[model samples]
Target: MKIFRRLLSYLEPYRIFLIVSLGAATISTLVALGPPYLVKLLIDQVLIQKNLPLLNYIILGLIALYLLHSGLTTLRIIYVNKVQQGLIFDLRNEVHHHLQRLSLSYFEKRQSGRITSRVINDVETLQAIVSSGAVIFTIALVTLLGSLIILMRLNLKLTLLAMIPMPAITFLVVMFSKKAHRRYRQMRRRLADINAILQENILGIQVTKSFRREKLREEKFIHKGEGYYQANMSVIRIWSVFFPLIMFASALGTVIVLYYGGREVIAGNLSIGGLVAFVSYLGLFYAPINQLNEVNNIFQHGRAAGERIFEVVDTIPEKEKKKAIIPPSFLKGKVEFDKVSFTYEKGKKQKEVLHQVSFTANPGDLIAFVGASGSGKSTIVSLLPRFYEINSGSIRIDGYNVKDFKLGYLRENIGMVLQEPFLFDGTVIQNILFGRPGASKEEVVKAAKIANAHNFIRQLPEDYETEVGERGVKLSVGEKQRITIARVMLKNPPILILDEATSSVDSEAEILIQEALEYLMKGKTSFVIAHRLSTIRNATRILVVLEGKIVEEGTHQELLEKESVYSHFYQMQFKENGKIIAI
Candidate 1:
């Protein structure tokens, strides 16, 4: 009940539409009562008297009543649709906006499909109730109540007898309600599971085909489809029985009314027309009772959907402290890490990925980190951006604690070029302008030239206006890498972090990218993580990380002289390649 009411609250903004719709519906239902009563008068008065003038008048009156009913109904439908569409828009927008504010860890723990279902499918279910089910329920309720009052006025004893079987019908509905709600909730979860599997398969279609796992993927989808099938069958099983029982109960009421009312008419205590009207009223009454049952079904479905929607709305988003400071517009680009440590939270447990790791880079210094995979090198740079908070100690930019700086302001001054470059589905110019939204076309072209991407972009079928397919799949790995470098060049932040940025390109492209990087790194504090030792030969300082700790720190020649971890790494690479080219 609470969830139902909360869902209705979304209608508050569209209350005027609600009011206009329901008012038209109520007036139309009242107008419906006139037809049966007119039928009674036509039978009892006009037909018996054989009055031609009164018959024509009655025909005309009935036409006018029907026209009025149709007009009011049209008004009701138009406004109801307005209210429904408005609610859907508001709810979906709010849910999507909240998703944008969530932390990266939140997405890491859940599938994209499950979250998408809450925003699309679940919200759609709630809208069904408001659009059709709720409106019909309201009309049925009013018709049922109005019919009862008229039935009693015509003959109270008959009305009382007809209502005797109603309590049993009510009991059946009450008993089914709890079970139906539970089943619908289960069905919603099953649907979400099916959606999850479908989305995963679609996203990984290439992998499945390459590994010859199409049959296996089909079997997996079928397994989930069976679960959804079972869930639906469970609801159908109970519904098939419940509906029949309700109809049987309604049939009993009609039987008793006919038995007694027929006897009264035979005795001349009730008129033929009055008894006919009473029977017609019974149909109106019992028909709405059936519709109310359908309303119950819709209500159960909506309540289940509402619970899922609110679950997302209630989740805590990334938080910012009240007193967080905004960093200066122009930063000096000095970075310091003092005894920093971090652990990645896996459910309730934490696995430390970095331990007492410390480093410092002065203004305009280029620092490089070389380590094996999973050695916590990326975690160190990620901490500087506050992507993940440190467990102990502090990291400062310039002289301010990183935590003290406002998240948006701090990140705005830092640029990153990741290993896998991601480009949205758009034109090349649009992707480049993403770095600085307000940058001029000339500036964008300049940045592209600096990153050595201008020549190829100009040669494309549409030049800068060419569409790059999803994740830049339309471009080669080298072309995509250069485009990303252009984006960062446009951003031109004082602090830059390049994580295996040039690793995907060929040797010739690597030289071009390195030249671009050297230009981008000038007069900036740069952090580079690389496995190719030749690229970082002139690094201001090279830190060799091992097992979540910095094991060696020195310049290239100094590290080679140490005859330790860095020296062994150099020796192996040099042997594998036959020689190390001096940069």
Candidate 2:
């Protein structure tokens, strides 16, 4: 349940690597203890005996010990690196899966830059704490404990004197670590905020240039940059105080040992070789102490990332209950919204966006929702795919409540195209084929031809292999929209949603896409949200929504006959052309 244990789960597959690495580190730490002891033995036994013949053998033995220690250390570091690489892959994969399943509303509220930071920057920081710092701290700690035992055994009085300042340093480290942790957590959050700003600015660079707000944006960026800079400096200040204090305490301990042990050696109470070994181990003691000072700082940032990652994964996913009251083996594209009332929490007054809205679309029906901005046309279409849950009512498909079907199964049967057609950075053919993974090249080409995109695609230098560039920026808006349409056509779902599909394209392109839509809408239940009434003039049914309620509904001719809300929309455009064409 804790962030640490949850994060550790990502490393589960590398259990063997962790165990082996820790073992090697332990053996390496113990083996490292051998050399200084060997030096003591050489001084006390071999050199002290005036035996020059054994000097060559002692040197050879020392070389072998160093080689063994090197090999053990290499093995330990290799496995730690292996675990780190694997864990990053796993954590990224988990984040990716959670992102995929999260409702569209979640993405609507979160920044892409912040999400990117979690996937990239946070993952790297987490791997550092889990792999490098964790392993090193563990080994350093064991070495410190093991060395203290040996030192105390050799000479308790000198060992006690050497360790006298350790407890005070330990208390200080704990206190400073807590403070450092708070500062580092703040630093990571500030970094995320800055990344969010940078990401947004880059995406809207065109708008910024158009509005001549370059200087204004730069000032905003500078402000965020300053915040991050200050947060980082806060961390630096803590480290500045921490590292120096830890070093002074360590130096004080060594000074005490030297002062007391020198007197003992002069009084014949300590051996020269033993005194030399004591001095050698002093530096090793400080190594672990430094890591101890910084471990909390490492953990705090890692936990912050873990918390962010968990916030996404642990969300209460869209409600799909078991033991369905109405279950259908297959969807029939018969959708009905009964007494549906919905409101977004953040909207003004928690105002209902859809008030007791109800509609029924028979199979092969072309149902279009027309309304002004903030009139909930898009929101109604979005609900069909369960992008957002309806506040009060049931949405049923083919006499079965939509909630009865498996989420994936329900989505797989519905096709949707948004106002802004998004394409991944891939070939034209690849982007078109994305709607139907595992689709053959023939199917992909066929779909492109239907959407009127195949001709332009073949004219490109690489044709099907030509990169779309980021979000298909290399292609014109009409080209991207056509490619998206082809993708949806390739999918061939029973139900379709077109949310201002041609609104982003030019007039000529809209006419071309409308032809494609005419064919795509045949033999399927469809919902269209359009600001341009001509786009949906041929729709079988048009519903005029105003203030969360269906103010008018009928065929284009029927609504125009009544001269209500729908008539107002239809006549405005007709009046612009100085002629009224009856729908």
Backbone clashes for every candidate come to: 0, 0
Off by over 4 Å in 1: 49-52, 471-473, 574-583
- Model 2, 1-583: lDDT tens digits are 2878877777788999988888898888887777777777778777778777677777888898889889988898899989999988888887778887777777888888888877778778878877766787787888788788778877888887888888889788778767866676777778888899999999999999999999999999899899999998997887788788888989998889889888988999987788888877766766788776666667776777677767767886667667645445557799999999887664567768888999999998999887777778888888877877888899988877788777777888899888898888888878877888899999999998988888998998888988886844378888888888899999898899998888788889988888888778789999988765565677889887887789888898898798597677567765475222332
Models 1 onward score TM values of 0.94, 0.93
The stretch of ten residues in a row with the least summed lDDT in candidate 2 is 574-583
Off by over 4 Å in 2: 46-49, 320-330, 346-349, 471-473, 532-535, 578-583
- Mind sharing the TM-score for model 2? 0.93
Model 1, global lDDT: 0.88
Q: 394-435, model 1: which lDDT tens digit per residue?
A: 999998998888788888889999888888899999999989
Go through the candidates in order and give each one's C-alpha lDDT.
0.88, 0.81
